[model samples]
Target: MTRALYSLCGADERHFFSPHCWKAVMALAHKGLDFEEVPTTYSRIVDIGGGFSKTVPVLDDNGRLISDSFDIALYLEDTYPDRPSLFGGEGGKALSRLVEGYSQMMIHPAIMRIALLDIHSILDEGDKAYFRASRESRLGKPLEDFAAGREAEREAFAAKLEPMRHMLRFQPFIGGESPLFADYIVFGALQWLRIAAGLAMLAPDDPVMAWFERCLDLHESRGRTVTAA
Candidate 1:
């Protein structure tokens, strides 16, 4: 009865980039869990089963099925409370929600804009048609047309993270002292860019860059284990 985490990967099974999936990965890592990685693509989620989920990061803990990264995190915390805590405590748990919202509201879009084309470039041929059709509908244009102006997007991303920059200047992590679910929340976004675009989105001197590196090195190179395929 081993555990398995279904991760969303690109054309190459090695390039697992879904930000939400990264959250689950880090959460499992923080809890000291050993699980097999099950790579998935957009068209393959249904393979998980009906009423369970049609998304990556679906936890197959032995026989149980859990979907949604946040829900999966909570499930892991509840199921393995004895392990190192992912949330830290009730207080950290609550603040992590704020981090999650901030990451989604401010950071996710910027990464997508800068790396959308990069992401598209890595998709397998099987996924390309579906990816293009679905994404283009929301973007109202071809992805190629949408992914222009990396410089402006990078500048915008930097400005959007000013608060995080100021915070990191004093604290080593968003969770203060050590990484917590809060750190995982934002780290997931950074992981997304790293896997999708493989682009250095930050300046060498930025505190956020330092934190990102620390995240990469966390949990015995957990973040770095998967390459952008």
Candidate 2:
């Protein structure tokens, strides 16, 4: 039986980057796992999840169900120890935790607001309509109103980047030599924000930008492929 990885289709266009999905996909790519990608909408997640919380990046390995991106990464690391190390080592593990915490607690929400502001320009009319309708149906407010209220909060988030920039060295990757789970997590969260807000161009000389490029180069060299699913 083949393993299956479920993700939101058109996530990139939707101005949504499921970090969980990215973690799983990166892990699978690193491990050379032969898994099938299953695409579904956010609505479908609730309908098919049997009353569980609706979330993308759910995985089915044979008959076992695994949810959450970090859990999936850990599961894969344990299941395939011979593959490249995502946590790197003790230092990598600690850094991973720090990166994950920052991404979850600080970066994601702010980036989301920025993305919401530019959603129309990034996505086509149908996708924009679908997303707006979905949000209204789920949250009972217009996307524009929501984004407007959160603009200040999002602007504050850019300050958090200062520490990240200071922490980064002239190394090619986050962990100094190779790209780790932290790199991918940070990349996934910030990359979409950068693209949607055009903030990356503002930091052309920053180490974080160089690190980001290195991450892409490393993944490409490893034949990491991302499809629509």
> Number of the top candidate by lDDT?
1
lDDT of 2 by residue, 1-229 (tens): 7798886545453334455676676677777778877766555676544734467788888867778878787887788789888787677776688788988778777776666756445554555677788776775777777777565766576576665677674556665667777777777776556545645423577666666666555645431243211
Write one digit per residue (lDDT tens) for candidate 1, span 136-193: 9998998888877766898677778788989987999887898888888899998888
Local distance difference test, candidate 2: 0.66
Candidate 1 CA-lDDT value:
0.85
User: What's the TM-score of every candidate structure?
Assistant: 0.94, 0.75
Off by over 4 Å in 1: none
* TM-score of candidate 2 on Cα atoms, chains taken together: 0.75
Global Cα RMSD, each model: 1.6, 4.3
What is the lDDT of every predicted structure here?
A: 0.85, 0.66
